[model samples]
Target: MPELTQAQRNSLAILLDSREERIRAQMDAANVARTVSAGPEASDMADLAEQGAEERMDDAVVDHYRAELGDIAAARIRLARQTYGVCLDCGEPIPYPRLQAYPAAKRCTPCQRRHEHMHAGPDGRR
Candidate 1:
């Protein structure tokens, strides 16, 4: 694959940096939610149920952010290795627009779709 232009590199760097910042901010929020205690003891089943739901949601959010951080880190490694915009599957160049939309994408759209299809669970979720 051809090397990314200086302009494309700069643009992708900015995009990755911004995404990392946003993910970190969201992680902080999720962490706070997990750490914060419900001020009073639950008086009824409803309150307990609500607290449980909130905790689950917070955990899910934090987990998602952690995964996103990993993806961003991998993308940064690719950037440093001068392999940032190449699809991992077909070794073709990933389009700039797709990279702009998802800075951590490892595969081109078609390859990604195939990968998801292959890896999807019985419920059709990847």
Candidate 2:
């Protein structure tokens, strides 16, 4: 793949930096939700059930945010390695528009679609 122009690289770097900040803030919110317990000492069964559900939901949110953070970190590493826009699967350049939309994207659209197809079920269930 050709080298990204200086301006393109700069724009991508700025986008990645902003993305990191948003992800960190979201992760912080997730952590806050995880830490706050709803009716921890409730005696009612319904309250207990609600609390359990809330905890489960909070855990899911935390896990999702953590996964996003991992992706952002990997993207940042790729930027540092000068491989940010190259697709890992096909070694093709991912379009700038796509990168602007998803800074952590690691593959070109076709390759990414193929990967998803292979990983997903016939019904597109992941």
Candidate 3:
């Protein structure tokens, strides 16, 4: 894999740092919400219902954010290893513009398209 240009590595590092901070904040908020939801005060019927709903929403949001964070962390590790923009599936250099747009992307468009095409059949059994 080609080493990231110094400028590219710098850019990716900044983005990864920002993403990590955002994910940490999100996880913190989720943890607080979870704690609140489980507290004895939440046992009141009205409080229980509201907390349940909020907990579900928080769960979904946290899951999404956590997955995105994992991707960003992986990309950051790749950057440190000088392989940040290489497509995992095709071994192609992912375009810089695409990386700028989605700094955590693991595959180039062609590889992603092929992957999606292969797995998008009915029943998703590919």
Candidate 4:
């Protein structure tokens, strides 16, 4: 396989930057959630409910960040294997614009659409 081009290298840099940002955000969210949970108990039912909701939201944000980090890690592995821009399903080169928009993409648009369609839930979401 050919080595990454300059544009691909730039995209990889973006992925690395994004990974750092996500890790920091995830850690911040986790720390805030921990601190809030360890603080004084809520004074009332409404306050307790509000605190619970906030904790759940924090957990969701952390989960999102973790998922994105996983994707970035996978992209890094592909880069190491010299297959970063190739569609995993079709073995075709993923477009540069798509990679620019989503550096961790593992499939070309058409293949991605098909994969999503095949895996989508009854409500049409993946």
Candidate 5:
């Protein structure tokens, strides 16, 4: 199992906290925009159409952030378990630099490369 140094743990905690805050803010903004766009007489046709499109985009963005936050939360749990830097695919220790760059990553470079290669072909034929 891969174990993070105290400093690395602290760094990951900070990054996760920042990402959580950002996602929360975005979700809040999206909610407010959605509410404003949903009321009666809020229809200026052009404005309404644009707001609808923007709201849909915001929903998609929120979904993406939610998924990312889930990954971050899972990473945090793995950190607490002292398994934060181990590759899930190969059971190898993930590189420290890669961990710094992607704290939520679940695979080492080689395992990730092989996984990507295995899934690269169209229609999942590989």
Candidate 6:
């Protein structure tokens, strides 16, 4: 936003890199766990249940990590285009603090709230 100040860009980039590194490490660990936890050599209901739980947990972690990676990739593209920190729906510059908290944010607070509301289910969950 506003061409993103040099300091802001550096700070955001650092944050992105740190998050990316953490997620990548998590993916690696999850992959290893997936391999190791694929099954228990001993066949028993208890072992099968434990393995199933572990696999489910690893699946959740991988799903989350992939989503974050995709968001980071899109954010990087915006940065390259000099549009990082700009609200996609409002065409306004999102605050630096907001960007600091959410480097991949594509909408300002108000717009994001409205969007969530619009997309929320009848039970008022988004």
How badly does each model clash, as a count of residue pairs?
0, 0, 0, 0, 0, 0
Tens-digit lDDT track of model 1 for 1-126 = 455688988998899899999989888876676667756878999999999898888787778888988999999999999888899999999988888899899999999999999999999986
Candidate 3: segments with Cα more than 4 A from true spot: 1-4, 33-53, 117-126
Weakest ten-residue segment in model 4 by summed lDDT: 1-10
* TM-scores, all models, native as reference: 0.89, 0.82, 0.71, 0.76, 0.71, 0.81
- Cα lDDT tens digits, model 4, 1-126, are 354587767766676777668688768868876886768999999999998998888777778777877888888888877788899998988887787778888899999999999999999986
Cα lDDT of model 2 by residue, 3-24, tens digit: 5687987898788789879878
In order, candidate lDDTs are 0.88, 0.83, 0.83, 0.81, 0.81, 0.85
Q: List pairs with backbone clashes in candidate 6.
A: none
TM-score of 4: 0.76
* Candidate 2 local distance difference test against the native: 0.83
Put down candidate 5 lDDT per residue, 10-113, tens digits, no spaces: 88778878878888888888888778867665457888788778777877788888888898999989988888888898788887788778778889888888
| Best candidate according to TM-score | 1
Query: lDDT tens digits, residues 9-110, model 6?
Result: 889988888888988998898788778766547488897787778778778778878999999989899888888888899999888888888888888999
Per lDDT, the best of the predicted structures is: 1
Cα lDDT tens digits for candidate 3, 37-101: 57566657898789779878888888888889889979978887877899999889988888887
Candidate numbers, best TM-score first, in rank order? 1, 2, 6, 4, 5, 3
- Misplaced by over 4 Å in model 4 are 1-4, 33-38
Off by over 4 Å in 5: 1-3, 39-52, 113-126
Against the true structure, candidate 5 reaches a TM-score of 0.71
